[model samples]
Target: MAQNTDGGNPFAEPGELDNPFQDPAVIQHRPSPQYATLDVYNPFETREPPSAYEPPAPAPLPPPSAPSQSSRKLSPTEPKNYGSYSSQASAAAATAELLKKQEELNRKAEELDRRERELQHAALGGKATRQNNWPPLPSFCPVQPCFFQDISMEIPQEFQKTVSTMYYLWMCSTLALLLNFLACLASFCVETNNGTGFGLSILWIILFTPCSFVCWYRPMYKAFRSDSSFNFFVFFFIFFAQDVLFVLQAIGIPGWGFSGWISALVVLRTNTAVAVIMLLVALLFTGIAVLGIVMLKRIHSLYRRTGASFQKAQQEFAAGVFSNPAVRTAAANAATGAAENAFRAP
Candidate 1:
């Protein structure tokens, strides 16, 4: 072998001098130096070897996230949807107001209808032509009803309850009278000497039932219905008399006719059952007397509040008398007769 120009081992294998680690096939498969730098193992830094796969193109660089509603800020140029929420609230409020107005209109319409009906009813003969419904007589009964008693129609709203209470009290009084009659009958059966009480009880029921309806009840009703001072005075007078009668009845004067406390106690020695019945009737009468007093006071208070007076009552009476056609004619006839008599005398 020729001596080498550069210093070399002459005894070394020829392939060793030409780089024994190099192979043509291996070199063809090996990656380039730049790609090999990507595979360098460093303890402090990490790297992945690049291959023909190209690392799946770095996972497409995950898309950026949008900002949350709380984090996002609005600009003046970008209009907010606040108008939509405000309009919804305003629409709801308007709907509620409209409903309230509609309800008021409905109430007014009902009131108008009621007034129209009243006007129509009153159109005939300058008075209401409706049939009397009070006394509640049957269709087949020969006796027709006498009055038209509608508290709602005749009395003011403030007085309706008081009038209704009075009506109920009257009904209670009638029932109490009926019960007294039965009690007196029982007493009479127990003692033959009690016949006077039984007879008087029947008379009391028959006499007082219609009389009470006419005297105090009717006057009070008329007082409230027309606010008549005269009617109020009449009620006070008659009701005072009624209260006296109630006291007398409750006293139970024997033989004078009432199943009262005295009669009940007297009969207790003779018969316990009769005594008990008379006692209950006496209690009923006593209750009526007390209720009468309370009702009188209530009515007096109501009267005072109404500004009614004796002068008003006199004026009402005078107006009523003068307005009567029969009274006017009689007065005119008397005046003409007096004038003729005076002329004749002269």
Candidate 2:
């Protein structure tokens, strides 16, 4: 081998040289990481190496305030979207408020419509059907004459009992009148000619039967039915007169042949049994008279409570008179005739 001056031997096995990096003191005294706390280990202690290896600690970050201060300094230069955000929030609020108001208005409109429908229903007499048809046939059925049906509306539930009692009284009064006629017939059979008395009885039935229903009872029925002060007053006046006549007839006054008193007078001279019967019939007539007075008082009390006055009656009467088709036609004809006469005279 040739002699080399750079080092002793290049190929010889590496020898332990005095290198600074390889010194134990330099290795032991190597700089520790700035972020971690270094712990001293004892050689004598039995220690186990950690199963998982840990990485070296990284360099420490700067103080927290340093980044915050830098961000604060840069904030003024950045663009803000304040105007767009505020406008969007306000528009959303306004749209929500408008929707709420619209819903409220729709609810009010629906309520008004419902009220209008109810009012219209009430105006049509509170009946299920709009058409004022007789017998009130079903909506699906063809129109037919229901003559035997209860075509008229019933009295109000509150007043039905009271009205029914009044109707019963009217029936009693009619029955009493018919009984008087029978008594008259018996008296005539004993005293006068039977044919004449029988004819009179028939005539009385024919005349009074219809009048009983139409003149007095029907008027009173209508009074309670309509609850009209005018009709009530009219019925009271007319029925009071009729009841007075009934009383006179029952007393057997000479002109009052329809009374039980007349029958009793005719039979009292002859038959005691017939006389007793006739007297009872007379008592019935007196009872009817008393009942009429009582009913008149009751009806008057009801009328007074109605807040109706003579002025209202007068107005109603005038309206009824003027509204009459016959009266209106006659008045028109009279006016036309007067105009023609005036033209002819001139």
Candidate 3:
């Protein structure tokens, strides 16, 4: 056995030192820092007694039982199930929640319905329903079909029938004029006279119908409706001129109507039947001219009662023509073009 030079482990045997894989129980325990078990040093004081560290009191022992039962772990806040039969308290709470939701939905539905009805009323433009008390319009119009709605606003209640009668007479006049055109055509074919009169008469009828309605009837309607001095004067001026033209057409002057004076003379020279027909046609034209004069006079008298004058008509005409947006725009463009052309000139 060899002695160690440095202080050696007293418990370690010479054979054990050679064999480190040997069981450690054979070696004596040493108080070295590398292999020490450290105790925690807490600065704070604890309420637990020294006995508490002596090992927890053996967990309360279960009571002796003949048979064992299974136990379930439960959370403190977990809700208990009522199985098939729900508790009355829970049922009442759920019903209250459902009722609140249903009431909210009902209120919303009522608000939506009210808004829908208001929208419908506004969209209909105040006239919510039809008022069909008045008599219906005639089935057919001889000259041109007139929309009752167009004139209904303008015409007075008492004078509505008078206006209707005037329209009927106008239709008759249109028919008479058409007949005169046909007569002129027949006379030209028979006598071989120049067709200038026939052509002019056709032109006159074609131009006059729409022009007369626009110039006379419209102004007359407006005058009566508004009791406007300007409108009445315009109606009177146009209508008087229209009546004069009618009288001239009825006269059958040299270049007027082929079927008028010339046709009458030729027919008188030839066949009695033809002459009678031509005379009747000429008489119809004369009657229409006379009717026009009478209607003009009647309307003029009514206008005079309203105190309309030529001065007011001139002012209205000037305002209507100059104040129009289209007229202003046209005038502006013309001025611009004229200026540009003058600037460009050599």
Give per-residue lDDT, candidate 2, residue 67: 52
Q: How far is candidate 2 from the true structure (C-alpha RMSD, Å)?
A: 19.8
Q: After superposition, how far is residue 261 of candidate 1 from its true place, in Å?
A: 1.1
Backbone clash pairs in model 3 (N, Cα, C under 3 Å; residues 3+ apart or in different chains), count: 0
Winner of 1 and 3 under lDDT: 1
* Better TM-score candidate (1, 2): 1
Tens-place lDDT per residue, model 2, 37-130, is: 3365456867565456578899898767645533454467676454678897998899999999998888667656655765786788775544
> What tens-digit string does per-residue lDDT give for candidate 1 at 172-230?
78888898888888888888988987898899899999999999999999999889999
Clashes in each model (backbone N, CA, C under 3 Å)?
A: 0, 0, 0
TM-score of each: 0.68, 0.52, 0.49
Per-residue alpha-carbon lDDT of candidate 3 for residues 106-202, written as tens digits (9 for 90 to 100)? 8667656655654675678744333332234454734433422224434554455556656665676677778777776666666556387678769
Which residue pairs collide, candidate 2?
none
Instruction: Please tell me which model should have the higher TM-score, number 1 or number 3.
Output: 1
Best by TM-score: 1
lDDT of each: 0.85, 0.67, 0.66
Candidate 1 residue 266 C-alpha distance from true site, Å: 1.2
Ranking by lDDT: 1, 2, 3
Instruction: Evaluate model 1: give its TM-score.
Output: 0.68
